[model samples]
Target: MDDLPIIELPEPYRIDEAQLTDQAALPQLMEQRMDAALQQIEQKASLRTDRHIQIMRENMHKYVEDRFQEAIRGSDDNALALVRGELKIRRADHHDSIARSEARVVELVRGILNQYDSATRVRQE
Candidate 1:
């Protein structure tokens, strides 16, 4: 065994080169990859044990309901209507903020993937 010839393994391929050639395409590719990854993760995640998602949903609903109730307290008929309208606007704003936060999270995941690709390419070379 000590006299055996050492075989050189082939170098790993870099996916980053294709990515770098068309930087604009990177975001689209990353989005598709991230979407697939998230789907895979969702499929594998233990839904039965996912207490945080349920808790967060319940908390948000309770918070909104509490706010609406507070606004209507000691209010006349017209004031109640005004408060209800205000609650709707606040809910819409909250939804928009959630959307923005989700978008940011997606971007951050893509950034991490990009960094991983760069590091992998460097290591391969």
Candidate 2:
């Protein structure tokens, strides 16, 4: 903790194998360790996801352009209006879809953790 910059990590969270034998230390150890693990996972996921989102945005217009032109030809309405509307709506829809997909992952992680905790309690009893 001291080795790092001006940041002061909570002293209570320090992990020392020698402290594991003490029953009173378990809660503190678990809380600190779990928070650190979650933060690390979030950081890693953000880096990977940002790269993917950049690529998705770059390819989106090129990928959907042909379909948009076809749809514009088939419609009786204004071509300019159709183009503008589809671009706006599709971009928003794409963002929303990505959000929904990420939400499902969050839900699945919670569900898995809940099941594991329940099973652990049952086994302990």
Candidate 3:
């Protein structure tokens, strides 16, 4: 062949047993990592939000109403004390920063809702 261009062959790929073993362990490793990640996500999601504050306030109010009713009915003091204790513990465990942030979010959302409500009212008018 006259004036032919020369081409070099590429090297062949190789696989090792250690690499294969590592590859086999990958799924289990990934699962453990994913579980940790999910736990972290759950913890973060469990942080108080505006809705949580609203719910807590509503629940506290309901508890007070129920306790009032119970008092009127002359219900067991021990049961009332237990409930009060549980509520106290929950309140003590409450994150003030989260609550404050939630309050701010509530105010912002309320303002937005009010704006939308006013706009709709005006449109209807």
For each candidate, the alpha-carbon lDDT, in order, equals 0.87, 0.88, 0.87
Please give the distance, in angstroms, between residue 24's alpha carbon in candidate 2 and its true position after superposition: 99
- Count clashes in each candidate, considering only residues at least 3 apart in sequence or on different chains: 0, 0, 0
lDDT of 1 by residue, 30-92 (tens): 999999999888876867447778988999999999988876774676787888999999999
lDDT of 2: 0.88
Lowest summed lDDT across 10 adjacent residues in model 3 is found at: 7-16
When 2 and 3 are scored with lDDT, the better candidate is: 2
Q: Which candidate is the best by TM-score?
A: 1
Model 1 / residue 71 / CA error / Å: 18
Best-fitting candidate, scored by lDDT: 2
